[model samples]
Target chain A: MSGCDQCALAGVLPPAPTADPGRPRLIAIVGPPNSGKSTLFNRLTGLRQKVANYPGVTVEKRLGRARLEDGHEVALVDLPGIYSLSPRSEDEQVAHDVLAGTMPDFPRPDAVLLILDSTNLGRHLMLAAPILALGLPTMIVLNMADDLRKRGGEVDAESLTKQLGAPVVLASAAQDQGLEPVWRFLTECGAAPSPVDLPALQDVPRCHAWAARLGRHAAYQPPAPPIWTRRLDSILLHALWGPVIFCLVVVVVFQSIFSWARPLMNGVQWLIAWSGAWVGSLVPNTWARSLLVDGVWTGVGSVLVFLPQILLLFLFIGILEDSGYLARAALIADRTMARVGLQGKSFIPLLSAYACAVPAVLATRTIENQRDRIATILVAPFMTCAARLPVYTLIIAAFLPERPVLGPLLGTRAAAMLGLYALGFLAAFATARVLKSSILKSERTPFVLEMPPYRRPTLASLGLRLLDRAKIFLRRAGTVILAMAVVLWIVAHLPLSAGKVPPIERSLAGTLGRTVEPVIRPLGFNWKIGVGLITSLAAREVIVGTLGTIYGMEPDAKSRGLQAALRSDLTPGGAVALLVFFAFAMQCMSTIAVVRRETGSWKWPLVQFSYMTTLAWCGAFLANRIVTALA
Target chain B: MQANVIRRRAPASLAELRKGEQGILDRLDLPEDVSRRLMELGFVPGSPVVAALSAPGGDPRVFRVDGSEIALRHDTAVRLKLRPAASAAAN
Candidate 1:
């Protein structure tokens, strides 16, 4: 009755009932960024939520089914956190479009659950006011109440409810308090009406002023000055100390990605090898055994072996992102990045690309400028991702001797590895500069970022993120990479030859490799290397597997035999050329697919692929010539 | 009193303030969307702001305002008109 009374007072009619009575009511959870909206959604939906992307965009749409206290179910959609309805960024536009019921895939929500941070009541309300004016059955959730209370701040929910004409609930999503009231309110509230002809909607200043006033009426008490935050920021944001600490943190993360993952990677490798051998014995037919063992097990397993490193990388990224340290890193890196025609915001995505480019490409969504985002994506793959590690380690082990460089502190092989990483970054920087100045030229947008107060990242959330990333990686391996592996296997085994020559040398892959060999020979790559290069397009790591399969060796953890064969087969110059080629080539199909999806065009991905391949060839030729001259 | 208030030198841009200085934000001279965004993040007129820390190269600095720290580049910070606090001026 009070909801309807408020609707009538606002001169708006209540929304009509759903066309299907049996269908569950739709509730949308919306809030500003870092307001704990996702935490609340997780609590409400638990494992019931489904993650998907909006049609034609990379923006995620998360929907879940939540059961109310009365055994009734309602559909809850977690919209992306946006500051206001006037959307500037694509992420903001998607959130705005979904809430306006303009996105065809999603219908208008029957009710709205607007989450507001109690600690920053005024700013949150600036966003809340626009949603409330939309005239839906809105409930204001004052989240982080526990944190507010700790700082001697209080919010009068009843007074806020009276002032805003919407039901307000004080909840601490992290502490899991005050959630039951949300379900009760949603169930009790019927179809909410749309606010019609609201004067505040037309004027931006009036809306802000009105929200500020409502914030006062709510008895909102601002939290005490964050002493701990200030103290930490003093050291962390220091002109000299900040960059040093950021570099150290990056070193630790990258080091851990390799060192911590080694044992687990070996375990995965052992399992794959054991299974491949097991399958080889079980299958009687040579072709069937080869397909199962070499195609699926070796090919997909080689890529999957990098999962531990990938998961570790995501975990570190999750902690950095959740604790709000990445923004500080961005601020520190902004000046250096500007020289390359990128803002500090591109720093995290480029750094993440070192772990894997797929997620890094997706992470570019945070960049508001379309041209900047595309430019960042265009150069992301050049950063030596974990996928390239296998090839690098293989080539280094085969070519470079393990001689101590810094009196046992560092070795020649280790130095070579560092050089490869540096090369990737140098290439990325040069590519970004070229792309920004030419193809994706735009005036620099003003850099403005909220430095969120640091908090302890919740283990539960971190674990969930790790699990989600692992799921996505495994899914890609199962689908795209698996299909590619099978196709490559068929190509490598087709037109069965009855001669003493190996099938791989006589198959379609062999002919294709031979055809391309002349073009690549200048770079010191033979037809076998050419074949490896072609299969590497599926994934960079697959080159190692493809080479193993081509050379008639088992691709597994113990790739020593393959390494020995490579050492005998390749000159040092050829080996360096191969490593250089893998370092710059746009070889990952997943990266290309994600780029196409992110840029919403085939044109950019094609350009990205061609330019990168050309760069790789040129770089490899130069490296080969230099090494050959030195030798 | 009115004459004295009028005679006070115009407020300096936020970019000119050294670290540890405090100022009251007068107005933002950025584009519409950007200024509105800055205001929404508690850069409203008359709010007390302190230059907290400068990043390496000192082009962008973190400013503490309304219990939140915001990072702004020099280009963006120059658009912020701020009246230095009397105590900060004395310091």
Candidate 2:
């Protein structure tokens, strides 16, 4: 078929397959950031997916089985978004390397669906020129078509298809439109002809010329900024009040997550507890019962209890990002971050680090400056992530009594939680400054960021994004956290010693803790405390479970609240020391691994390890000594 | 050649530039390395520049380059120097 004609046939169905092909077609979705590439991937793949590390590399490679209308299944891989194939940063380099099959483990795609926002077709298609030049079989998915229609614009999709010499499918992922056509296009297209094979070294004028030609053929126009955006920017982007508003936004965000997720969190907690008890009742032997109840059920239950909190936090984040407030937040903070040895681009990742640093560190690939990327990686671990929530919550509940503050204006519990949240942020900032001066001693990288125009966030889009993040979190916990939990359970429950002087003291975990006691003694951490810290490195909430196991408590362990248990067992000074230790520590291994992978060096991970440990040591030492003196 | 050939000339090569000199940003041929970043910081082709400020203590040095002020370490600045501007080119 003629290459131009092939463009028209894209998104159209092919004749019935003559042979039964067992191999799956690999279709990759590519586009600029925030252009709805991820939205399209979510629509196509849904839940039938697996996130394998791109074989051996640390980058997450998502592969999903998408069954077509004809019942033929294809493997769809969602690649990291890039503005162009001429990559500047590590993430973009991963994109470029994967696309070129330069990465040893990544599979070459059979067809690429280059997603374009119909409203900004020209700028979006700048990415396409490079991909199309790769001579891969390709189709263009014109995403956000509905947004275009609202702005009094229309893409002559067919004419544009012919001009670009690739098939075009118009879709709005949020609306669930054009998905079937997209599926058909990807499955049928193979070995499509190259559209424009421009050399990589060609300068800007030629690239712009090609972009302009494509713009004319596509009838491209970027819509004017919306009225609501301009109005919001006047207040939200106000120099003085902007940071204040941003802080208020953060406070409200955390408060809402705690307030709204309470009911849901309670329900999940009830279900997991009920199921664990039910399973324990069914098992015959004591050892079997404890293994199933304490090891498997307790591990999953601990991870699952955070589900509601995680979902609510991510839900708010998704809305802010999709509506484009995040971009403005970055603009407002750009100058402030410059003083702290970070670019404004560091804010999104740092902010996301609060919910979870694993994804935040992964997201730093969006920062193009190497120094900025490295500095971001160094500081990201310092942000108190959701993993630290259990520790923070337990400590706050234990130390701060429910004394009504601003009587009748706020709940005492709520106010205490807020204070601890502020403390976490302060510790994070202080730690970031320390790291910046020492190992990450580079100058603040200058950054340029695109502030996409604001739009009303669609509920479907927000839900899809929230679900995606939760899924990623759950998958990581399922493998890494699950394995760590079982190992820790054994360490906490082993050796079958008889005539024990206190059951915990005889356990393998206690033995291991005692072995390390001398090192941790200055921080006021005993053997049991030492064990909890090690087990918690896998996921932070497990600290509560580890404490439960160490204290000889049940799987459902609410009889002795985590707070009461800590307060009663730990000396007041010891409690304060532990709080200070957790406040400055890198408690999650997943974040460290992700950082190592992203920076492509052990250098950063090692520096983060040593520096954070030392900070935790000194902070804990000071806290313990001061609290003891006061006592 | 133009009267202000030095300033108006696109940095034909970065090799011609030197430390401590000031030049108008005649044309910014942003290398792929710096382009995406410069774009993000609102530094377009027509921005201005000034002589680099030596850092105080171990602090990162500040630059009055590209309209807005920016900070960079000495190592990175060495990677970017300035060419002498013809007299009329002074803004």
Candidate 3:
């Protein structure tokens, strides 16, 4: 089409609809891992995509609107990267279902965009062959074409297109080259041809041979590895140096999360306090004033202060994942993971659990084995997620002295924080071992992970990822945490009496706390702490907010900060016990709901909750006794 | 069959090969699902392979096969029978 004709067509179309009017023509993007499918999707859709879980499963699918040159819009889906059509993992199953037209929620695609890594064309086509045989109009994009050319490799796209009977485009997604050809092909390619003649899916060996034959027919030749890549792999994948470097990287990341985010956290806290004060002065009525300042501000502000730390944590994680170090880390961790009867692939999800169990549990879909996936999901919450950071920081700042443990290098508080994280990991490991030998016992699956070549992560992609994470966290705060805060405020303010007694002690939460007091007495918690613990079931971070509201509402405590109030009321032993209780407790309702949804049963979540609660109480009691004895 | 057996000694498992050693994959003595996955990752019979690197414990090692690096546990590696490459055998 001529440029003028295209412009005319674009102008003739009605104003673009805000949302898809009907079932828009579907175009699915499918590819193997590290083929730059996601990069291509990002280029095609920009910020117009929405990410949501598929119906009934926790696999995330990205849907966006792609406008053709004729101004006709089609729905573009970015499917999770998978190796082949044979469904081994949940993610692969989702991709397979959508292709087979079996997923009730998703329509069969009008075309398939099969992206292949030009540098590893042979293996990538093994996945492409099955997709092409499904009879959909397919366009093969040779991503990483620049990297191929730099290594003295050449691909004749014309010959490959003729051989496969599909349109082929050579593009470097990372360098942003050769995108116009893709759009042109999508706009011009109208009707899908009938399914190509292909050998039946008999066995793995047969599939490999077929793919190898296709590679030769297409004249696919992988480029020589760059000298620097070889040299770096020698050290990074070495037996002796690999684990050491990995441990050093982990240490640096954790230290950065603590030290780098401190200033930002303090600023957020200051802003919250300032706003609360400003709003407090405007509303003079005692009840409304207290509800606004003491209830909402103290409750929600405590959780909002943790946003900086969570962002920092995800930032480092994004770098590690994007730079391709996470795969190597998983390979190195496979040995230790095997000892616990888990596979190497479980490493990333479990490590991510340290950020938050909700996403970590969702990430378990990558594990192929059902038993292993469930095992990973079960023990994920044991890791100290970001929710516990607020509680740990509060307790450590209030109770633990900031004396240097390593003579200006590390402080006692830092050591305690690290120890808590280590404790979480140890508990998860032990739990995995026990569960493996008993209820979830199964044969060990082979660990075959593809280690992608490392590339410097682009700023735009990393910024987008960090922004996405921030959005999810803020959305949760806005909905679940905000609702819980309002409900908690009402609960802590009910049964108003005419006397001078504090409303918190006479409120519904007070009664509930007293009811659980006898059970928690041995753990060194009073009714107020018990109230915080009970409200924490909504979320672990809510404990901080709950305590803030409780202490904020007490008589003569309005001017004093929550931290100061906690220090005067709580003993050191009690603080340590509370911290230990929170460290192992399954206090996140969202985590529980995710587990139930993922496992397709409440049986597992109930079992998980009970066991974790038992462990938390026992650990808290021991911590209290030991600290009290030592003091 | 007897003459063919006498032409060469038994093949060595990948786990027994030291670093930098080369071998041709013979067969995998593993479960069907596991062996199938291994083959899909370019560990088919007659594929040339080299021991690339190992972890600290010397259990899970990275093996270079068909221009790609794969990490396998020692136990899994032992299940893959391989014939030592001619150059390595000659050396």
DockQ of each: 0.52, 0.06, 0.46
lDDT digits (tens) for residues A1-631 of candidate 1:
2234434543353452375688788888999888999888888877777776787665778888887877988889999877777777667788777776688867777788999888888678777666775667788899999888888998789877776667888999988999888878668764343432223443455555666677677677888866777788889987678778999998888688768888999999999999899989999966788899978898888778878877887788788888888788878888988899887879878987987788788668667667788899999999999888878998898778799999989999999999999999999999899988998886444677778888889988888778777877787789877898899888888877673225677788989899999999998889999998988888887878778878888664247898888888888889999999988999998888778767766888999999999999999999999999999
Model 3 misplaced stretches (Cα beyond 4 Å) = A1-21, A194-196, A278-289, A343-374, A384-423, A440-444, A498-502, A521-526, A538-579, A589-607, A621-631, B1-11, B83-91
Q: Worst ten-residue run, lDDT, model 3 chain A?
A: A1-10
Please state the CAPRI-style docking class of candidate 1. Answer: medium
Question: B28 in model 2: Cα distance from truth in Å?
Answer: 2.1
Cα distance off (Å), candidate 2, residue A222: 5.8
Candidate 1, which segments miss by more than 4 Å at Cα? A1-17, A191-199, A239-241, A279-283, A362-372, A393-415, A441-444, A498-502, A552-574, A596-604, A624-631, B1-11, B83-91
| Clash-forming residue pairs, model 3 | A239-B54
Docking class of 2: incorrect
User: How do these models rank on TM-score, best leading?
Assistant: 1, 3, 2
> Which candidate do you rate higher for TM-score, 1 or 3?
1
TM-score of each: 0.89, 0.75, 0.84
DockQ of 1: 0.52
Candidate 2, B1-91: lDDT as tens digits:
5655554453322233333445443444446446544433323333344433222232233344422234443344444534334432555
Where model 2 places Cα greater than 4 Å from the true spot, the runs are A1-21, A52-60, A154-163, A168-184, A194-201, A217-228, A238-248, A348-426, A434-445, A498-502, A531-575, A588-607, A625-631, B1-26, B29-32, B36-91
The C-alpha RMSD of each candidate to the native structure, in angstroms, is: 4.3, 8.3, 7.1
